[model samples]
Target: MADTEHSSKNVTEVSTDQQSNQSSKVEFSEEEEMLITMVYNLVGERWSLIAGRIPGRTAEEIEKYWNSRHSTSE
Candidate 1:
């Protein structure tokens, strides 16, 4: 019983780590970046509006991406 419990715990931990890794490695194509910048220029930081124009991207993700991109440039 203890061995089974330990094995299950390890499996859960590994899966959780994999999920985090996947989520942290989001990549945006150059076209997506250009669209994001264009929309941002038109609407300012209205992330949801920008996201609406870019399929598969959430407002939070766009905001995070914008912040990271700008931060590194500055």
Candidate 2:
């Protein structure tokens, strides 16, 4: 009984961790993409300001996304 309970607890903990990991992924909607573009054109590379205009997005996340999409790395 004790081993079974412990195993179930571990499984529950793992499930919770997976949920958190999934939530951490950043998914931008079409509107968000358009907003980012318009905002970027207005204020190039000012990540914090751009982030402020978008809800639920951190400056670091916005900056990373912009760099990944637009960085001139060839």
Candidate 3:
């Protein structure tokens, strides 16, 4: 009975950890994509200012996404 209870507690903790990781993933809406593209075209990779225009997105995420997409090409 103690082992079973400990197993259940570990499962709960693991589930919470998974949820926390999932929450950290940044999802972009269509409007956000449009805004990112428009701003990218105009300002040319100013991630901080671009992120400022986007709600719920940090400049680091913006930079990471852009780099993931464009770094190979450049």
Candidate 4:
């Protein structure tokens, strides 16, 4: 039972690490950067409106992309 629990914990840790690495791989291009900046400028704090203006982009998607780019650079 102890061995099973340890193995499960190890597996979970490895999976989490893999997910973190995958997330770190995400990034934005220069065009994406400009778009995000433009959106913020146009809408201020209204992220939904800004996201709507960009075809197929959601607020969460933009945030995730930016975060991933930052993480990779760091």
Q: Candidate 2 regions off by >4 Å?
A: 1-25
| Full-model lDDT for every candidate | 0.93, 0.89, 0.84, 0.73
In model 2, which range of ten residues has the least summed lDDT?
19-28
For lDDT, candidate 2 versus 3, the one ahead is 2
lDDT of 4 by residue, 44-68 (tens): 6566776786777777767666554
Distance (Å) between predicted and true CA of 11, model 4? Answer: 1.4
User: Model 4 segments beyond 4 Å from truth?
Assistant: 55-57, 64-74
**Where is model 1 more than 4 Å wrong at Cα?**
72-74
Stretches of candidate 3 above 4 Å error?
1-25
lDDT of 1 by residue, 1-74 (tens): 99999999999999999998888678999999999999999999999999999999999889988987887652
Error in Å for residue 12 of model 3: 17
- Please give the lDDT score at residue 45 for candidate 3: 81
> Residue 2's C-alpha lDDT in candidate 1?
100
**Which tens-of-lDDT digit does each residue in 39-72 have in candidate 3?**
9999988999999999789888887667765787
Candidate 4 vs. true structure, TM-score: 0.60
| TM-score, ranked from best to worst | 1, 2, 4, 3
Q: How far is candidate 4 from the true structure (C-alpha RMSD, Å)?
A: 4.2
- Could you give candidate 2's per-residue lDDT for residues 1-74 as a string of tens digits? 99999999999999999997775567889999899999999999899999999989999888877777788976
Error of 2 at 8 (Å): 22
Best prediction by lDDT: 1
